[model samples]
Target: MNADRAETVAILALGWLASNDELGPVFLGSTGASAEDMRRGATDPAFLASVLEFLTMDDAWVTAFCDATGVGYDEPLRARYTLPGAEQVHWT
Candidate 1:
């Protein structure tokens, strides 16, 4: 039961950043090695931990985003996007 509407988180994140016009180049990864680096970083909880270390979002924001789009924060950072209660069986 991978989230019915996956990719929603990333799209919203990017869209929100774009809307703010503050999407610094520093927050993004290029398509080749940078992309690879991001993916790699995602898997290293410590790395992802560092990447998200500064976020100051409220749970309300996450809830609102999910409510607004009917999705979960299941976007694949480095991990497979699994639905709220699923076993994450698809990507293996």
Candidate 2:
């Protein structure tokens, strides 16, 4: 995905997380982000990447998110790779 499309997916993921009663608080707790932080972070590529990162942690979460958003299950990970802070580390 291109950066623009990746960002759009990340924003969708954020909305999904925000509306999930069960997982919304978990996300906030996991990321240490307050509501205000979320509002501020919406435009940050790194933060959006984190949202995708969090979303892809569980197969069920990814499945549910994809189902809800009508996107492919792999799209989140793909989008993550296209976003900032997602560069692969080369240790060779």
Candidate 3:
């Protein structure tokens, strides 16, 4: 995914997370981001990358977000790597 498409996916994921009552607080707590912070972070690629990181941590979250957003299940991970600080690690 290109940066723009990745950002769009991240934004979709953010919207999904925001509307999820159960996961919304969990995300905020995990990231230490307040509602205000999230609002402000929407346009920040690094912050959006964090959002993708949080979503990709759990398969269920990924599935739910993908399902809700009508995106492919693998899109979040692809989008994450395209963002600011999500380079894939190699242990070879």
**lDDT (10s digit) by residue, model 2, range 1-92:** 89998999999999999999999999999999998887877899999999999999999999999999998888999999999998879999
TM-score for each predicted model, relative to the true structure: 0.30, 0.95, 0.93
Q: Spell out the clash pairs found in candidate 1.
A: none
TM-score between model 1 and native: 0.30
Better of 1 and 3 by lDDT: 3
Instruction: Sum up the clashes in candidate 3.
Output: 0
Largest TM-score belongs to which candidate? 2
Which residue runs does candidate 3 get wrong by more than 4 Å?
88-92
Question: Distance (Å) between predicted and true CA of 14, model 1?
Answer: 10
Put down candidate 1 lDDT per residue, 1-92, tens digits, no spaces.
Answer: 32322333444443443333333243553222244555555344333433322121445444544455554454333222231322446866
Query: What tens digits encode model 3's per-residue C-alpha lDDT throughout 14-62?
Result: 8889889999999999989999988888999999999999999999999
Which residues of candidate 1, in runs, are more than 4 Å off?
1-24, 28-33, 57-92
What's the number of clashes in each of the models?
0, 0, 0
- Give candidate 2 misplaced runs (Cα > 4 Å): none
**What does candidate 2 score on TM?**
0.95
lDDT against the true structure, each candidate: 0.38, 0.93, 0.92
